[model samples]
Target: MKIKLLVVGNTTDSLLKSLILNYKKRIKRYVNFEITELNIFKFRKIILTFSNQIIRLFIVEQLYRDFTIINNHPCHNQ
Candidate 1:
């Protein structure tokens, strides 16, 4: 089985990437795990239009899990 993670923005921080990679490596021990980072700068235009299909593909490809994590910030609105 293949597990794919579609991250919305490019991770510019090295520390963040390292942490994510560490988790991904741990996940790989039990399954085929992969991360696909979609850069907002490069794909911002197409993302809005293609987002639906992208999610659909993710679900159709294998067992689906959607986890959204949001950090609290002074200016953040949710």
Candidate 2:
């Protein structure tokens, strides 16, 4: 079983990369990290799924970098 860690970025840079890497290290035990470009203006509807779990939805912010979080599910795996 493998969990998915979604990291979205409105615009990516060094900071965003670092953020993803940092969070990835913490989350590596359970999930595989992936990053995607997003629209800052309409991030509210962006749904993040972790191993099929919708961890975040409808997040609104002027994001210039990345979004990071820690999550665990029943399917959390290596």
Best candidate per lDDT, number? 1
Give the Cα-based TM-score of candidate 2 against the true structure. Answer: 0.31
**How does each model score on lDDT?**
0.50, 0.38
TM-score of each: 0.49, 0.31
Candidate 1 TM-score to native:
0.49
Question: How far does residue 7 in candidate 2 sit from its true spot (Å)?
Answer: 7.7
Clashes in candidate 1: how many?
0
Among all candidates shown, the one with the greatest TM-score: 1
Candidate 1 per-residue lDDT over residues 1-78, each given as its tens digit: 687777665555555556556656645655687888666577344433344434434442223222112222222123
**What lDDT score is found at residue 56 in candidate 2?**
25
Tell me the lDDT of model 1 at 58. 40
Q: Which residue runs of candidate 1 sit more than 4 Å off their true CA positions?
A: 40-78
- The lDDT, on a scale of 0 to 1, for candidate 1 is 0.50
Candidate 1 collision pairs? none
